[model samples]
Target: MSKEPLYSLRMRAAQGGAHEEGGLHISGGERLGFRDEIEALVSGLLRKALQHSRGDADFINLTIEKVEPASCRVLSPLPVSTYEVADAEEGRRQAAVLLRELSVSEQAIRNALCLLGSVNNLRGAVLLDSRSGERLDTRGERGIRVSRMDWDRERYLYWQNQHPLFGSPRIAEAIALATKVAYAPGTVAELCWSDDPEYVTGYVGSRRSGYCRITRLKEQGDFSGGRVFFVEPGTFISEYIVHLERTPVWIG
Candidate 1:
């Protein structure tokens, strides 16, 4: 008998009437042997999307993809702090300290955290001008989508040799994107909190600081989360985006 394929689901919704284009409103997960559970999962997600969109979503998109497990490589867990916090508030304080250490300005860090807390979900990272602490629109409400970046077997193996935190494909992908953004010219730093309700650990990173993980960055069960990339003044957003989308980067 053939083994069950892994399933990935993503659902997003747009609010009705006049609304800002980039607030997340996205829900998704990956599973194994969930064929019989798809219908129920979709129904639950639809309810969430509409509710998060404020009861009247102008449109919603749901996508499901199945792939063999052998086709993907699992990566190692990321390097996390030795200390842990029991609650979100404590997590926030720790995160603040970490971001500050990375040289992220207080104002920019505050703005970034506010955006993540308010958005129902963000499909991509928001770009912020580090100096003024304001959002930088690269391509309208769509934010910077960090996808299409997967490491090949050889490259992945090479990374494994360099660092012990080179497991878990999902974590690796997140780090890869973080590294790309952090190293991009004019980028100051990055802040990210996941939208997964159960995930409370988030991270702050920069070319100088490397990646630092903080647990309890968000309230448990809080679905609002996203990423922010802080950039320097006079940054050529267009070129930065071109590099972000086209460049291949690896983390050690």
Candidate 2:
């Protein structure tokens, strides 16, 4: 028998209309801020249920009957006892294998799977041949780098206008600092904060990070990789680490 591929839960919002007070009225009139969250939750639950099932029938299919109140009705055509037995047996076997391979807890794996399923646009990860300097898609075909330079500039301008600290003086300083480095045409630079609110950093490289943080932006999946730019050590003298660690590493 062919090994079962890892399953992913897919969610569809119940199509319908809007209710009073500007509330969305899905099939069940369930109010949800984002559809992806519901998808993740459902996917996680199915994985959990399957883990407890004891059967050779290791699959659990779910259909969203209604969205307005977010209700799901599980569907299993096979006999419940047979399915449970097979699923539980397979689950234990898989759990043993997974435990040996993975260091993280089962919950973390489920959580990660849910997040992966919840993501609406994964922007397929590409591979760039470092030797030939060629950009290739997942299938090894030539790929194009999507340019968001203009959008980045616009966003920077908007942020500058909105923040008092990012006014003309700071903007000019930033521009001067940026000018020292030659940024490629498609390259995008952004000022972002680390997990800590107090730690702010500048990034100049590929579009992946920007694509993740900026909603309006879409990653072009540019595989045409290039050199990374960074200030040479001693370029700036400051108490903190003034120099960048390394050049751009090719992300395939």
Candidate 3:
């Protein structure tokens, strides 16, 4: 890839793709206020954001390359016997079987097979990473959810090590403050709890708190068994904590 500047607000309207290029109602006899209604909705959203943020505002930059709805159906629900297995290994085997039944991405399927990050945690529908979080998709009628993953070493390390969360009150407070400085509001983050145990542990957090509130516990351990994962409705990826799309911004 070549070095090029990524622009702000390069996004499309929620229903931008469905309309025609020469204005809406390609056929005649359409409602007059249709386009205006969309503009009003967008303006209202922006106003609310500005009001809530109180100054420091940034234009979210993204391009809608593709959008997919939770358009697949499962053949069957998980068997009740899966939760009753006694042995952990056996439990995982059964869960893996159930996971294979879900019509999600290969990554999500693989993670579920390995028992990563509450793979069983389904919200009636789930957003699986089919693309590198650069793609947006819908979860039933919920609308587009965004997904982005950060495997970059520099960002991930700094995210965890810089004034990292600890059990101490003062240290905890410091780490909390640092988290605010690190990421912006409405950002959902993946926080690790000390890389240990047999499996890699990860949990999700929102902008309201510096520390993750155990969206999925079992933090750090049994990772030798599999990777970590997070499940949710279509993700509304905020631009603040989002991964680097071009040159690294946080690092000098």
Candidate 4:
């Protein structure tokens, strides 16, 4: 019997003329066992991406790649400051403090946390108007999706040069995305909690504050996860997205 090829799927979608930076570019292959599973997963992902894109996406493309497992490079977790909390309530309290320290408005923090707590593991994030505390995501319940940082050549090259030091592909991508978006015009701050079932360490970040990991954002095994980006009141949504998809960032 032949061994199954390692299958991975990559996506790039954009509205109007953003091309490769269409604000949704992500890839996953990891432990997939069969080609059929890849097809099913990719189909579902594209559908979700389309819905979240609000019909402005001019195009969406899926790329399938097969590789040998031996070609992959494994690495340890990236070193970041961790704030341990005794329980979910404590975690929520600490998260509020961190977000406030980043100058995230009180109302915005309250709404963001509420959304995260109430929703299931969302594959995307919520965009909030910090000053008004209004939800800005186009899809409402579906939220808005952000990615494409791993596609930026400058950023990817930098990440590569750093090697096994940058951590898992998922976390590394998150950090890169957060750092780039932090500097984008009109952005205030970003928050994230992982959906990996047992993971409880989430982060609150801004251009000035950097990334701070907080444990117990939810109870272990709870599985709910999401992200939020708080922006200024008058920020143009399209322009803000343009920056997030097109700008290249370098981490020193």
Candidate 5:
């Protein structure tokens, strides 16, 4: 296996490079060539760095030369930090990998990092785009949450009872606190987002029950179980602004 640091690997991936999933990965900037696209890559790298750096003072330099109005040249080696930042980040990454191998719950890892106190340095500004695999770099961003309504109460109950994230009673606490308005039994909360209205509704959310949930499950067999955390802010900024604006976050 390559001995390259995972951050280095991820940074390379962010910069229109290859990833483990496949090599056909093209960054949004590479495909669309927008300044925001490039900035998203930077933001994602920064977030990962912040997670690994554990709150060390750091800075990254990006040099871009315009090739044309639609595209630019990304000069190589946009080093985010030197010395302590890199070392500390490597330690954090090693810890995360080792802990995960031991079957530690993600919440446990996060809680341990929280006690370290530096991981909170992000200030709630990190936004990761799962579809495009990009991130927006900023302290303020529009955010969304998306989860398919396939997990019936039975699956939810099973997961809540058996899943590692649920091993801690704190998962219940977190879910309860995170859930804005608790749903009644047999009902579920849902949300969706889209960049274009034609592709999908700008935003859709509900707290009702119907057979449609089971129909969706029957339709998409692969996406059967998931607990999503966030959605791309740029694609759903309109909905995010109207209903789900974010506050500055230092602790979480």
Candidate 6:
């Protein structure tokens, strides 16, 4: 079977006249324009749709229809005077309910983190100590110390068991805590490790280890996973971390 088109938005402007006055025609076509904003919007919409699907076979095969600005205006005009005001209000109400449901679930948070990580251009993950402070190397030394709190090991373990199909246990655990501790609007959590040749330890015969970072956390849920976490070499996010061989040097 042919793969679905990576993009699903096609804008066909009228032959002549201002785009707004003449109005633009949008088609749910396979071709997408080269504009950065358009591409980002398409990707964000697709990601959100997929996350809502949650591995369902039907949604996996579903396609998005084109959305038009004019249609949205007609359907949800300002000043609360549009004919579709009631319908628009109902849509908003339904959306609010769904948001409440998803935001409270830990799985939704992890999925969001994953989607966010995918869109980030950065290659490395940030490291933070248990206290939510950034963990950075100083003077070429490791083992940074910070405040200690009763780490919620059980909660982390629970998240790991729940998402076996997704991220590594250790990474999942980290993400779970990060979601509750370091989370902020539009921030995403990333799992990173020291894989640089310069950072590799001769004893392990590898140059890298594992770490995690929390980035943008947002409310729109436009990303694929509910909460997204970027993964890097030597630092696998969620499920990937579980696959690595056990090492005692790195403590949670």
> Candidate 1: which pairs clash?
24-121, 24-122, 75-167, 75-168, 75-169, 76-166, 76-167, 76-168
* Candidate 3 ranges beyond 4 A from true positions: 1-186, 189-204, 213-221, 224-252
The per-prediction tally of clashing pairs is 8, 19, 12, 1, 0, 30
Tens-digit lDDT track for model 5 on 1-252?
112211101232221122232232111111112344456646754554344312222333233332222211111111111112133344344444433443434554454333232221122222333233233323321122211111222434655565453343323222322232112121122211111112111111122221011111111111111112223224454444222222211101
Off by over 4 Å in 5: 1-120, 140-169, 177-229, 232-234, 245-252
Q: What C-alpha lDDT, on a 0 to 100 scale, does residue 112 get in candidate 3?
A: 36
Q: Per-residue CA lDDT of candidate 2, range 147-240, in tens?
A: 1111123444654565544354322222322322223222222211111112122222222221111111112221121112222222221211
Model 6 residue runs over 4 Å out of place are: 1-139, 143-154, 166-169, 176-191, 194-252
Runs of candidate 4 exceeding 4 Å displacement: 1-79, 151-166, 246-252
Q: Which ten residues in a row have the lowest lDDT in candidate 5?
A: 210-219
Q: Distance (Å) between predicted and true CA of 240, model 2? A: 30
Q: Name the 10 consecutive residues with the lowest summed lDDT in model 3.
A: 24-33
Give the higher-lDDT candidate: 3 or 6: 3
What residue runs in model 2 are displaced by over 4 Å at the alpha carbon? 1-159, 168-200, 211-252
Across residues 1-252, which tens digit of lDDT does each residue of candidate 1 receive? 234544545556664422255433443322222467668767766776665423456668767666444543333323433337888778777777877776668888889888888876466678888877888875444567653233434656877677665475446656766666766788888888887676777788777766777767898678778788888879998888766654433232
The superposed Cα distance between candidate 5 and the true structure at residue 57, in angstroms, equals 21
Cα misplacement distance, residue 39 of candidate 5 (Å): 44
- What 10-residue stretch in candidate 2 is worst by lDDT? 74-83
Q: How close is candidate 4 to the true structure, as a TM-score?
A: 0.63
In angstroms, give how far residue 150 of model 5 lies from its true place: 23
Q: What ranking of all candidate models by lDDT puts the best one first?
A: 1, 4, 3, 5, 6, 2
Give lDDT tens digits, candidate 3, residues 1-58. Answer: 1123212121222111222232111110000012224354345434433332112223
Best candidate (score: lDDT): 1
